[model samples]
Target: MPGLRIGALELSTPIFIAPMVGITDRPFRAFAREMGVGLTCTEMTAAAALVRAPEGVAARLLDLGPEEVPVAAQLVGNDPQVMADAAQICVELGADLVDVNLGCPVPKVVRLGSGAALAREISRTAAVLEAMVRAVDVPVTAKMRTGWDYQSINAPELSRALEDVGVAAVTVHGRTRCQKYTGWADWDEIARVKEAVRQIPVLGSGDVRDTALIEARIRAGAVDGVVVARGMLGDWNFLEQTVSQLRWGEPGPTPDFADRLRLAKRHWDAMVVHHGEQHGVRLSRKFVVWAIKGCDGAARLRARVADLFTQADLDELYQDILHAGEGPTGWHRPNFTSGEG
Candidate 1:
């Protein structure tokens, strides 16, 4: 795959890690960068919240570690001026690119006329993105769902409008707002959006789990790139494997049980350092669960995860997880979906 350029920002590859709320924090992004993801985005931040409290919000949601550069800071809101101001804040805080989130399907966001709801209001969404483009010298991009519902699949029209307003690029999640990740993501609709836009790069999202699915979306949708979201949940090596397969036509080195254990430990340590032990240990439970998802006796390990409150708790369970992994080792896709991004 060729590199992707958004405005003056050049990415090494077209593959990007989707900006998932609560899941794509600084530690997670750092690990993704090490794993060879082309671009990493900050988890979605509310424009109004970021503008009202830049320091607090940025610290909580937009904090980028040293390893995380060439990163896109994603903002979500319905207000044009607030979004513009937030874009400026993101740029000030070392964001290489600023992205508007128009694909979030959560009811609160839609109720505020943001996220997927804004995609239905093309002119309004265009106005918001246009202001952001004018506000930041860095690339201004948008990620949106196909439309409000199947009855109104208007990503093509919306993409055209965004491009006309000087938006750098657009990513289309193939599912509609109504779908909310229930069924399959329609790559055909993503291809239609690609056909509609003349200038900016068009990327596709949803249902991109493994190498085969990634290749399928690129070929079938004929998009400029693909965003790996839920697919990267437990499998951080997904991007590395993808780069190897796409660039070299060979699968990259797969992690054995020991390799996984080492990386998982590193990930937990980083999380604790970044988030502090109390919160980090609490937050790391889900990641531990994801890492051990398909291993033997995964249920028992997961049950132990719930009681994890400190490093000692995790240390005690680590041996058990490694012992369980002695039986078999292989990649296991995460069977889940996220409503964010």
Candidate 2:
């Protein structure tokens, strides 16, 4: 696969992380960068918040360390002017790129006629994209689903419209909003969307969990890149593993048991540093499970880890779990439901 050049930025490898809600927060992104990922994007922000008041949650979206370059800020809204103004604020805050999200399947966003709902109104979606591009001097890109439903899988047409208006890159998630993560992803459909555009990078995103799936998608030949989402949740070594495979066509060294524990502690410390003692400890509960997941003795830690209220408690629980015995041969993960906020 060839590298993509979006303006002054040149990504040597095209494997990128998909922007997930709580899963792609600041601490998680910092860990991902340590594992050698190329680019990282913040969670979606409300354009209205950025425009009306640039403090609190909006300011949090612009939080970046000096080393975190090429961080793209994603915006979700139906108003072109609001989105345009938000993009300018992000640029001033030092965002390397701006992305418009038309791919989220969550009902809250869709009910508001934003996110995937934009797919239903193609002209309005295009107008928003055109307006945003003109307002920001930085490169603007898009992340879109196949369409609103099976009856209208117009991603190929929409993809072309985005490219024609000077979108720097395009990422197409193969499932329609109606599909809602069910059934197999339409890889061939993504191929068609890539064919519809020229001079812009096209990326395939959906159901990619490992090297085998990534290799098949790359061989599909339409996409210029791949975005791994759920795959990274429990797999901290994702970037290192995928990059090694892409570069040397071989596997990277797996972390030993102790190394996984150390990584988990590092993540816990960062969460505490950012969110403070009480709140950070609660938020990091699930992350502890994900960090130690798949390791030899990880399962023992799941049930009791969430009870901890401080870093010391977390450390003690890790020791207890490590002492519990052989972990499950395989791990069980929960399914995402609409009930979640």
Candidate 3:
């Protein structure tokens, strides 16, 4: 597949990471960049919080190192002005791009008529996209589901509308809010959305678990790009493998047992540096379980991962994981409920 361009920015490769709530945090993004991810998005930040408590939200969520450049900041909310204000703030804080979340299926977010709810109201979605575009000089993007539900599929129409208002790119997740993460993604609908957009890039996100899936999607012209979400959780080498496959017609080298452990250690250290000792250690637990996936004796190691409370505990657990034999013959894919926001 060819490279992708979103406004003035150009991506040499089309593989990108989704803005997952608990998974795509700062440390993970930085680590992803090191591992060769083309672009990374911060987990969704509430537009209301960015407007009402910019300082706190910035301190807690939007902190970015210089190395994390070319990263997009994703904001979630229904209000046009508020979302715009938050987009501006994200730009001020060094975001290379700002993305609006119109695909989050979480009940709490949908209750406020935001996320996938916005897709149901095209006028409101247009207003929100317009506000965000006008609010910042950087590129503005929107991530949406096919529609609120299968009965109301509307991504093609919505993509055209977003393009009309200067959205730099559109990412369509093949499932609707009502469907949540169940069932196969409708690549046909994703292709329809791509066909609807005239200029801006239209990326696809849903069940992209490996390089072959990515290759198939791009080869089918289903989308201009692919977003890897759950696929990245436990597998640090996934991006490298996908990128190599896309660019050279071959997947990248796989990390052996020691290499995997070393990568996990670096990730743990990064989490601590970015989030601090107590909190970072706690956050590392899920990632640890993910990293240990497919390794031998992982089942035994996972049961003790929850007992981790400090950096030392994490170190000891890694030791235990290392001491345990290599994991299952084929690694298990990390499983998480998929949706944006």
Clashes of 2: 0
Candidate 3, residues 224-265, lDDT tens digits: the string is: 889988777777788878987888877867878778778878
Order candidates by TM-score, high to low: 3, 1, 2
- lDDT (0 to 1) per candidate: 0.84, 0.76, 0.85
The C-alpha stretches of model 3 lying farther than 4 A from their native spots are 54-59, 338-340
Worst lDDT run of 10 residues, candidate 1, spans: 326-335
Tell me the lDDT of candidate 2: 0.76
Q: lDDT value for candidate 1?
A: 0.84
Q: What's the lDDT for residue 46 in model 2? A: 79
TM-score of 2: 0.91
Candidate 1, after superposition: displacement of residue 167 in Å? 0.7
The runs of at least 3 residues in candidate 1 whose Cα sits more than 4 Å from the true structure, single-residue gaps closed, are 54-60, 216-221, 326-331
Q: Which digits, one per residue and each the tens of the lDDT, describe model 2 over residues 186-298? A: 88888888888877888888777677567656666767778877766655666678866776676578765566566667788888888898888998887777655554556
- Evaluate residue 271 in candidate 3 and report its C-alpha lDDT on the 0 to 100 scale: 91
